[model samples]
Target: MRILLTGSVVATCAFMLFTSGRTLAHDYKLGPLAINHPWSRATPGGSKTGSGYLRVANTGAEPDRLTGGSSPLAERITVHASSTDNEVARMRPVVGGLGLTPGQTVELKPGGAYHLMFEGLRAPLKANDKVPATLTFEKAGSVEVVFDVAAMGAGEGAAKHDGMAPGMHQNGPFQ
Candidate 1:
């Protein structure tokens, strides 16, 4: 009985330690940018592209924009926006950047005013995995975040529509 009790305690401790380490391993902060609910989609092998989503809350009294971002996986990164026009969803790069008014939170969600354009991916993003991203803002500077990769075709129309996160349709890189 004593051996069994000891074994149970040891097992519980081991489990707690393992879980704690996993959580700590994934915890990262990106300066003033409080990244929340970041997610992405799985991509094919050799594919040079992927997308990321997150929310940014500006706790200051000034406005800002997500000007730029970078990652070792991408050759180029840009902020974009997509919307519906004439019943057709069109994507255009949001010139300048996404605006964040004072005390207003901007969502880098799907099918809305913000999208992360990853140009060159070093490896395929697997489902249920995490991808590292570095986001830059005009006033907030740069922040690093890990995007939890969801299934492909998962992030469709998450901003305006009721469906899953469809891809976005916005204009070119910022000027």
Candidate 2:
């Protein structure tokens, strides 16, 4: 009877651990990096592209670079940065990689900043959906992360949108 009780307790503990891991899927840590709140906005219907945002904090003495990433949901994933020139917004693929300085925090967010550009999405990302991605770094190597799907038009930073028409070139890599 004691042995059976011990086995049941072990099973319950294992189940709790599994569920808790899923509940905290948005946060992760590896090496000297602490990744927080990896998330993405819900894609509109018929949209084949989406973007991901996250905050990476470097606590080590050495710097690192975010080389690339991959996701099963997208055919290609690339890191990109956005800029505006004379009221014209343009996005270019980050040539080498996004740099993370030692003791500094880097935020991949919307509205003219660093973000992950996901092209050829297999399906539209819905609210509350979780997208799994693998990020490759220069020093810290590769880590698999889950991106929490937010509502459509959700901005990670302080940017605000008032329901602008779709394809208006308002947000995203191209604006």
Candidate 3:
């Protein structure tokens, strides 16, 4: 009876460990920041660039800035924002990084918003593939997270492909 009880306890513990690890794979926490659902869209063939999005919530009293990051799947990763003026869309790198206010939640989504620009992709990011990335923050330092690859052209709210004009060379140095 004693041996059976011990074996059951070990099995329970192992099960919990496996499930917890899977849960943590999609979300990451660093200091006062909680990063949720770091994800990207699958790129088409012959595309050398891709984008990533996520939500960062700052729970601390102080603010932080998302400076930059790196990924093994890309040559370089930089923070970027898209905007439109007079019906013309444009994209530019977020100079000095993106600011995260205290108690505020910043979301990097598709379309005209703050997102990650991955230049020189090693290969096309396919749907369901996980892209590992390291995000550097002003206060939180660096935290590694995996970005889940969603279907191509996925975004927040309506799934319209905004600001991504065909052959638009507005993505700063990446173009």
Winning candidate number (lDDT) = 3
The TM-score that candidate 1 achieves is: 0.67
How does each model score on lDDT? Answer: 0.65, 0.77, 0.78
- The order by descending lDDT is 3, 2, 1
Model 2: per-residue lDDT, tens digit, 17-126?
66555435545678998776678899998899899888788888999998778899998778899899999989989988999898888778888478888889999999
lDDT of each residue in 12-52, candidate 1, tens digit only: 77766665544433333444444445667788888888877
User: Top model by TM-score, which number?
Assistant: 3
- Which residue runs does candidate 1 get wrong by more than 4 Å? 1-32, 156-175
* 41-153: candidate 3 lDDT, tens digit per residue: 99998799999887788888998999879999998888999999899988999998999988888778887578898889999999979899899998899999888888887
State each candidate's clash count. Answer: 17, 0, 0
Q: How much does candidate 3 score in TM-score?
A: 0.75
Give the winner by lDDT: 2 or 3.
3
